[model samples]
Target: MKPSILTISACGIFTTGIAFAGEQHLTCPARLEPDAIQPNHLPAGWELHMLRPVYLTEGGMLHGPPEESAFLVPDNSTSRKAGKQTREMQHWSFDVPHGYTMWVYCGYGGGGATLKLFQQVTESATECTLSSQSTNGRTKEVLEFSCK
Candidate 1:
């Protein structure tokens, strides 16, 4: 059975209807960023796969196919790994507008990886600020904002 989507308004997080299957079913983009993968020093057979962007309204409703929806997919890459304790490093470039919620699902292939969202500095990749709050599902992360 397909999982149902439930949003927790107080926190802007989604919970699946499945008894204890804590994540939303989403796929990681198949395209790989060679430059990102090559430098990661990942194990053989592991590579950086991008996370596809899913947009939603602040009320947790699915948003649109914006004018340039194609660009939404594969904005950045994350390495495939086997444990949730570690998340491979990669620079992400997607931004959630001031009034929407965005969810990015990263399937590390073996089902284990912690997900977090960071705000990239305007000019430096290494300089970033962790979001004040974030919600992590089994293989996904979400960021939300209130409409002004």
Candidate 2:
């Protein structure tokens, strides 16, 4: 079943942070539009090929990465007080294309996500032959899950 989160109207990776202690926030995917993006906003690390759209994992709205970010630092002071920004994101955004959306997330550090979504390769009318795929795992499973 799709998440009730589908009711949302915008999508993006938004976060809040702390300076030196453990933290938490009320987080959810927001809904948005394609034109909300600027031409230069979709950088390589954020997109597949230049024209490919990245889909958000919730209602699957395509959105850019957060404009602002949050980080953690040592509560006890030192020059370490300035704190380093964390690029090791637990959450990320994928901008959509033509209003089509697909969203994904990993359980932790990308452990649960699979390969990129792709259309199957097909034979060329005048040239191609056959293609074969050999692998250890033949089937991958996606299931409905939630965390409290």
What clash count does candidate 1 reach? Answer: 0
Ten contiguous residues with the weakest lDDT in model 2 = 119-128
lDDT per residue as tens, model 2, 8-92: 1125333222111221112222222443334445566685232332332311111222121111121232111113321112222
Q: Report the number of the highest-lDDT candidate.
A: 1
Each candidate structure's TM-score, on Cα atoms with residue i matched to residue i, is 0.19, 0.18
Model 1 misplacement above 4 A: 1-71, 78-91, 106-148
lDDT of 1 by residue, 54-131 (tens): 222111112222222221332243444444432333223444555443333322233232221111112112111111
- lDDT of every predicted structure (CA atoms): 0.28, 0.23
Candidate 2: regions farther than 4 A off: 1-15, 18-21, 41-148
In model 1, where is the ten-residue run with the lowest total lDDT?
A: 124-133
User: Could you give the C-alpha RMSD of every candidate to the true structure, in order shown?
Assistant: 16.7, 20.7
